[model samples]
Target: MATELNKGPMLGQRHVQSFLLFSAITVNFMTKFNAGVAVVAMTDAESTNPDFPEYDWDEMQRSYILSSFFWGYILTQFLGGWLCRRYGARITMFASTLGSAVLVALVPWCVSWGGWQAYCALRMAMGLFQGFVFPCIHAHLANWCPVNERNRLGALANMGIDCGTLVSMFASGLIAASSIGWPGIFYVSSGVGIFWCIMWWFFGADTPGESKLISEAERSYIENSISSSHKAKEGHAGTSIPVPWKAIWTSVPFWAYMITKCCQSWGFSTLQTEMPAYMNGVLLMDMKKNALYSALPYFASWVMAVVYLIIADILLTRNIMSITGIRKTINSIAFFVPAAALIGVGFLDSEQKTLAVVLMCTNVGINAGSTIGSTINTIDLSPNHAGILMGIANTASNVIPIVTPLLVGIMVKDNHDRQQWQVVFIISAVIFVVGDLIYLAFGQMVTQPWDAPDFLDKERSPNLQEEGYSKALEAKESTNVDEAKRKEIEAGLESEEPKKKALNDEL
Candidate 1:
């Protein structure tokens, strides 16, 4: 039997999972983006604060370093989804985080052994280990979060990205400025990742049922609120369902999501990895101030992400707008606004440093609205296959991370050249607009037919639609019979009434 929903507090074991996931993500991104900051610290020739010698790495080598991680990142995306489906989200996420932590801890040693080559190798390994993060999170959230809470919870979890970037930017600068130098950034980040893994292992579970910590009422409410087909019932071990690869591949809305995600990734990747470098190379900012500048945009992004989440939830809960309308509107703001901001950034000169910082802040801050748009759409499209769908979409989109840095590296042969930087921003803005247009045209928020566990079987069975029609016909006939009986009773009453009137006249 379906459990009735309580009208009170929504927090419980599920929220714990969200918080654990958030911590893990924060650590994950902290380690992932440590390189973004460390590279700036490592390469900045003008910085006198470093205790260790700075590398004379040019634009191309740094690009190579930044892009190498995605090579391994892209390799494991599909596998991550598969693992999430087979082993459950808890184990996959655990493995990803733990392995990434171990690899991150080893990065300094690896760099000592092989210089840039070793650094790139270690970064790739880190990506390989961490590639499962998104698919696993999607899979986990699918089980734990009810439809009504999906937007708010998912956005909250992803806010870790902003927080992580902020910390990495701010901390890396101060640490690099200290006697510990550039390597301290990696050590501190790795330590945090390791700590988060320990917490996750103890507190995290794949589903509410698996969790010993969740109250029975909340567990029942969660199970009953989400689609029953997606959850395993009592006394039964959950089994993996087959993926509808064909339908997913053919899905128009999914492709729109893919395109938009790729566009966002490009802009995000370019800004995240390159922004600190831009601050150092173009604006001639010191390492500490560079970190502060890099951190500010992410802080704003985090704040706006929460704002978008609140608005989204209100619109959804109150029926103020349809899901599709809200998604499109929020997504448009995310893309179009950022697109304009980036153009403004491209046009700014060195004298306009303050204006440039503001534009950069606006670019990332508004992009946070996408947390409500494309980020949660996988669940909307297919609650059952959310993980796999996310994997497929992310796989298609992850190509951007590989391409963006390399392209930026090539284009900005001289990092100090503002014209080259302007071209990069304009190109990114164009991609963002193009992606937004595609999403507006083809994006859908409703569940697709291919989301069913039996969708493949139904496709193979030629008589399925016919069988549905037959059932409908039977129901229609039954309704017709009842209607005919009702009419006959009305006719009998009418005839009796007329006869009674005639008898009264005769008397």
Candidate 2:
């Protein structure tokens, strides 16, 4: 095994993959959130942009358009994971982006052909194509990220969600206000998505071993840091490794994670899909103003996500907390703090616009910490099946996006009514808190028995298993020895004490 004595450049193929993942996520979300901003400009009953045609639609109809994407989104969550595991992330993500880009490019023509109904169909189709993105990315990262670097690398890749949302919200308004008008939104977004697809196809690979740009030293370092169970042959057929579906289905920790993911999605979908309506109807902001203001929370979220990543990396590297402890702690803060902020938003009236916006920003910014927690926890529990677990958990969670908008439409029948909005916020707050509590009780970082590839072949590999156990013990001892020497050096730096310090004296 490669030890601390062997080192390689921190920036390598892994970092390149991180950059590509970041770009892909940003473009994916840009397409996703374009509708959020474009709809405002399209149906702005008060707008006087003669070049852009305004649609006659009620809040209910608008809600349907906003919610339509999830119809196809919900269908492929599990399937995407399965396909990603069977094929590879490179192909899955490439196809997802390419298909979504084509649909985006056609949105304007679809609206012209059949109005809202046809446009809704297009969005559903786009969702179907984009559904493979997250599971594929998660599976790809499982192959690339070492356990120690998970928090930083995962946070870096996921930050694209916030950045993409920020750009869409900020740019969509400006684009609609430009001479190009609402159609420009779809056109520009499609161009960006297509550009990303081109880059991905040329530069991206499924794993470090497959990458032409990676160095042998860096590749060896990555392989040594990762656990044995996660190592997959570069071009092996999927039939070689059977998924432990029954074990996964029965895991309590997995269910807890699913609950937390659902709750987060509920809050996120609410903010992402309906915040514009809330700003326009209750806050009485125009489309341009709404777009600018909507961008703020996500900007704050992206910045705070960086802070969370830094802090999480520090805690892990310094041994300040156990892996499970860090995940639980960060997750609690992510959920509970956001819940409080959402509850606070409910009580703020239009008269307190600044306060309301600040609270909303606070909710999203703090919630970004979830990237380090439930988002990356899939790999912690079972690296081999990270893709499948992502599918299961995300598939369950995405149902929230479908239901949230409908429920919001019902609860806030009068979109301008602040009291009704309060009820929505309170409901979201409750879900967030409940989900965290369940995770605290059952979520874990330990690898499960089902994660093992050949647990059932005990009789055939008893001697091999024994040999592996002995090697693991040797590695553990080597690690302990290095840790002891480091502590001794630290003790020497502190004021020299005549008495020898005990093992328990150090952190």
Candidate 3:
């Protein structure tokens, strides 16, 4: 019976297992960086091989090819969020992971077919599948991990970037530099993705309570924590506004989250896609060395974020700090660190290449704050409704990729000038500082609907008023015992029809 009971809803121990499983899947799903990891290895071949050999290639053309993924990613955010809300996280993850795998497998063909055009089309398709991955992951984690444990668990999934980055840089670099040509790198990475897809197909569940193998003790613990939420027996939890729209559109917290997300992405995306090329062009890094420098900043960001999340979550759940207070302090620390590093990046001009790399590493590390401000806070705002919030924010912020490519295109003087690259850094630094200010001033971690006067607690059965009338009782709004009694009397008196005496009988 206990085994049978665990498989019904979002609050079971099996749900916890499902969350853990998706973390692994998510990490595997995002490592689709053939552009960054395999590029240097393939470039010479692409330039020389008869099929794609000898095209006029430089940093600008290379950047455009890489930026193509964002176009597909941003386009899918809205639809993906809605689908995750409607279909369930497991289905979306299963589909997205498989979709990306198919697209990745097509990369070598793109190289052989139309070259850059083929590469661009396949990358856009990769982006489409990839867009749904984040929102769907957010939906699962929101339900599977209780609020207090949300960030560490979220960090666990997010730590995929590190895992993926490590594989792409260290693993792929050695492969590219060795006997395997650039295409061999994708062949290896794509295998990891396909394996994860099979695992998800067999094991992934939409919710925890729906898992078959959860222990009773673990299920009881999860139920108790969420008992105050939708898992609660009645009222607010049951009446939860469909989709958490009231808070999402109207609350000050939503914008704060979105701005911080954009700021963080603006800074982080620069490193992931552009930094390698910048090092090659401006700092004079060769291909093999560029892989590590390009890879280091992301490595640092991932580690720092994991440490911050564990410590902060422990403090918040233990009542050592309020959500807003912890958010302000940690985000400030995270922001200032990178902001300071980026401020120095403006000084890079080729002569100070070593100093420039140090500044770049420091600047990139600061963006780890995104996990705290945008990613983790979904739980704080409303655990039940977090997934949709993540979707809305993702859809909004990913525009950075669209805007950034153009910005860099316009700024770089033929892609080699140090001044243009420096300008992009300065601009990123300003966005981060401005975003930090918005979150510090206006963001709140949670919202309560009953705080409004007109809001009816919807969990009451439809017959409450009719039953109250029969019992000669007032509506629930009566303020005190005395008021309740008086209102009851007034209600009874008004409710009764007056008896009429005939006029003829009185005469």
Candidate 4:
């Protein structure tokens, strides 16, 4: 047992290991979103098909079926965060996926004859599992990537989320049209989710430093990050950070993130829960076209988000702007792109389907700017509790899915009413604008008030240097000091009377 100190730095393997971790993370992510994607992609055809009985295709029923998952999703945020923390990311997350997969396999069977309540219940069950996805991500990402890379790494990890939704939309369209049809879609997604569990057990590490799949240098890089973070903390905090709920909950910055998350989800979940139905029913498109068009916005948005994050990272690494600048610019523009794109949608109709779909893509793409919502402030406000804070905010976002649909349901009574959707769009845009503004006004790049070394001016108890101090270097120096003192004493003895005693002993 050499201790965490002697782990020793190795150079040049971080990028490779990061990629492997990202890939492993992606498959897990794909499993997580499979249900949402499959349902969206399957919407048009299933609703119209007489071959399937549960495929009622009624707007209210479709809306109900789709909207029901959010009920379960929103409800689980509190428990999901705690479960992830207690069980470890791999265990809790895997259980969610595995359970969801089993449930998914049962969907076609239940939905066909079991009726709306049963189907809704299944969706709720799925939501319970899905709620853990982002929280698990927050926990794992915090553990796995370094601080400097947190933004880009956060964006990359999130790419799995966006990519899963898009790929699901794309692949489900392909599969839904196959001979197996709608049920086939759920069946395939269920299988993928189950298979992913076995893969996770084999490859996933609780922390990146411990993953066998991670390269030594990568491991060293992660280990060093943990070590360096506590350099200033001395030995007070120990290996795990203490949870400070009062500070986390009462803080304005944390609330700002919650508000921003709420605003963003107010708009984003609209896309997730209702867009397929909206595109098909409101825009007067058929099923396949609905699926294809549904995916375009996410596809475009996904690409823009990655590029946006990389550029932000470049500016940060280059010192082109303060981290605050990055957060402000990203959030403002994220709001900007979507707001403009959504407004454009209000003016279009089925005759302008091409332009309308492009606008949808731009609108959602801009939400990628919400990465600040996902990564920036959580670390800034509470690095010690970012994951938990994210869980809180993620829980807040879940509130949107629950409320938005009911609001939209009342507003749109008929799915085809562009006027109603336009109102919803306006409401969503305002939410984003105001939320983004609040963030720019109050949010920041540093953690809490206590994070500053001298801010509170508490007597310098030793914990201050934990993240910042090099215990390894100190240990090496202490060993050298002890060895040198031993040598000096031995030499002095030899010089004094040791040689005479040695000869006498021999005689």
Candidate 5:
């Protein structure tokens, strides 16, 4: 009753989905950090463009604005996971991108009307929607990518973070300096996000089976390769898998991974939110040069992520190292190297500008290894629960961004004081080192027992089983088939008819 489909093209529909996912992330981060770049222009003592109004917001107010996005961001992580499970990643991501884009476009008007308070509220609302991003991404990856290709595909999708940051940081200053001024930054990001939403609406699919464009062979390949276990099969439909709450909370490896994420967040937030200020105060760079230098590190990070992805694929495919070994090894390098680089960054003064830039680049660039490390390990642990795991971890981790800016505002009364920044950098470095050690001690790459509690159960819902069969049938129907192939499929369907009747009777 079953037939083997021929393999499809080397670059299949999955890659197209990956590219769209990548573009979505790129647009998301552009919206996320547009404020980080725009704020510098907003608060400058003298406006480069006389047509735009500059606010006289103090350091504390600026910090609040910068951190406001995370305030709402922390509230929606668990909600995002639930949404992704109930609906699908495609729809969840669409809502996030569209809502965030609309909010971003409203920012300038909000700031003009209610001042900093209104601006913060808008950013928080944007954060609430954008919070769905990573959970949806992980959930989508789990459903779409095969086990053998997870590393490269995951890296390709997540690389958008660096690419988005690089593009936004570099272009924001130039856009602000142009005739359109700082408002152009928001408008541009919003426009790109809306464009992506349009593309995704037409093309994005939750699973290969759901896609009209995916070939039968490609769909079969992805589904078969991913569905190695009962849990994997269940996860493919975006069904609501039962949450193992006690098991997840009590898991030591999960906690270790969460701690590592938190630590990385602290270090990452410190640099991402504060780098513009650092360049302005300490390096004495103008907005344009500051943007260029700030962007360079993320460019390096993007490059390094690709390199890490290739190396990781080689190690796995060649069996040079186990997945566990590769994860820990790359994670250690990501954490320790960045920690050392950050310390070096702290000690350098304005006089050592070139060296400071180099170290900053190293600190950010080498950190890309973490993307290959703990980021996608949620899927490795439990494909069925990857979205929920990502949600829990991200909820805890994003708190650091909210707190880091407020702490920096408190600790550094004068941004020009090198000693003050030195303290901040040292704290971040210490966190990075400590986090990696915990991960090295307790992290795992193998699937957990809790991934499928239904494994031992002999009976499953007949309705669910029928639903899966119908989806496979639909996928077969959507593919272009020759007369002979159609005959074969019709015969296969005829053979499956009795089994389908039995399933319906059982239901």
Candidate 6:
């Protein structure tokens, strides 16, 4: 591994793969949030550019349009996992982005022909394709990232979400106000998506072994590191292990993670989808100011995500915390601090616009800690099945996005009413607090028994099975030791061989 490292550049092919994944996520989310900004120009008479057409959508209608993406999104999460496991992340992500681009281009015509209902249908179609993205990304990272570097590389990839949201919110406003008008938002986003599809098709890969672009040295380093960590027999190329669905469903830690995921989704969707409207209605900000302020929070979020990554690496490399402790600690900060800031935001009056912006930024920025926390917990629990696990969790969590806007529509009858918006913020805060508390009580970062079910057969005695598992891990780790240590381990194994053979004969 040292020789391989010396032979390659300081940054390897894996870093290139990470960068592409980051760009893929950025493009995907740009399309995802484009509607949030464009909706202002589409509906509000005051905000609409004179050159563009405006629709008279009521609050309920607007809510439907914003929430519609999750309708089809929910249906495909599990399927995405199956597809990724069966095929590969490279093709799955490529297909998703290409389909989403085509659908985005059709948005203006759909809305023009049939109004909000047609627009909702188009968004739903886009959701079906885009739903595959996250599962594929998780699976890809599991294959490409080393155990030690997981948090840093994972953060780099996930930060694309914030980058995408920032660009969409900030740039969509300018595009909408240009000579091309509201339709320009869809056009520009679609064009970017298409361009990304071209790049991903040429460069994206599922694993280091499969990539022609990767050096042999880097590939050996990644595979050896991952194999040592996972301690499972690597299967043949183009095949997958059977999913332990029953085991996953029964796991306590998985359930805890899922519940927190749902809560985070509810709060995140509420803010991501409705914040522009909040700025327009409550703060009375115009289109340009609304876009700029809404985008600023995500910029803070992107920056804070990097900070969280750095802090997490310090705690890990310095041995300041156990892996479980690190996960719980980071997750607690991600949830509790944001919950407090959200509640604070609710109490501010319209005159406290600057304070409200600060609070909202705090809420969103600190929330980025989740990327290093529960977001990557699926990978920790079972790297081999991370994609499928993500699929299951995402399917349940994304339902909250569908529910949030409708709930907001029912609660906030008057968009300009500060009291109603206060109620919405408080509810989100309560949910966030409750979910993190559950995770604190029940969540774990250790790999579960079921992660390698084939190795630990049900017929084995529990104590014997656990002892054997430890021995196997020790054997794998022995390979990385110095020659002196390696010789000692070999001698020890040879000494036990006669007893092992005698025991086997008796059995």
If both were scored by TM-score, which would come out higher, candidate 1 or candidate 6?
Answer: 1
Candidate 4 global lDDT = 0.68
C-alpha TM-score for every candidate: 0.88, 0.88, 0.79, 0.80, 0.87, 0.88
- Tens digits of per-residue lDDT, candidate 2, 160-205, equal 9999999999898888888888899999999999999999999998
Give the Å error, residue 387, model 3: 1.4
Query: Model 5, stretches more than 4 Å misplaced?
Result: 1-7, 45-47, 228-240, 453-507
The better candidate by TM-score, 3 or 6, is: 6
| Colliding pairs, model 6 | none
Q: Cα miss at 48, model 6 (Å)?
A: 3.7
Model 4 per-residue lDDT tens digits across residues 1-507? 444343334332334433434544454444434444455444444543435433445555655676777778877777767776666667777887788778877877786677667778898888888777666666666666576777866776666657767766666666666677767777887777777777677766566545566656556656566522532123221124446555667788778878888888788877766776678666887666766887787788788877888788788999998888888888888887788777778778778888889888888887877775434467666544555777888887777877876787778877777888899888887887888888888777776764433433342445656634778778889999999999999999879797888899999
The regions of model 4 sitting more than 4 angstroms off are 1-50, 226-240, 372-376, 450-507
Candidate 2: give the clashing pairs.
none
Scored against the true structure, residue 218 in model 2 reaches a CA lDDT of 77
Report the C-alpha lDDT of model 3 over 408-461, residue by residue, as the tens digit: 866886556877777887888788788888888877777545322223345244
- Among the numbered candidates, top lDDT falls to 5
Which residue window of length 10 is worst by lDDT in model 2?
230-239
Most accurate candidate by TM-score: 1
**For candidate 6, which ten residues in a row score worst on lDDT?**
229-238
lDDT of 2 at 358: 92
The weakest ten consecutive residues by lDDT in model 4 span 230-239
Q: How does model 6 score by TM-score?
A: 0.88
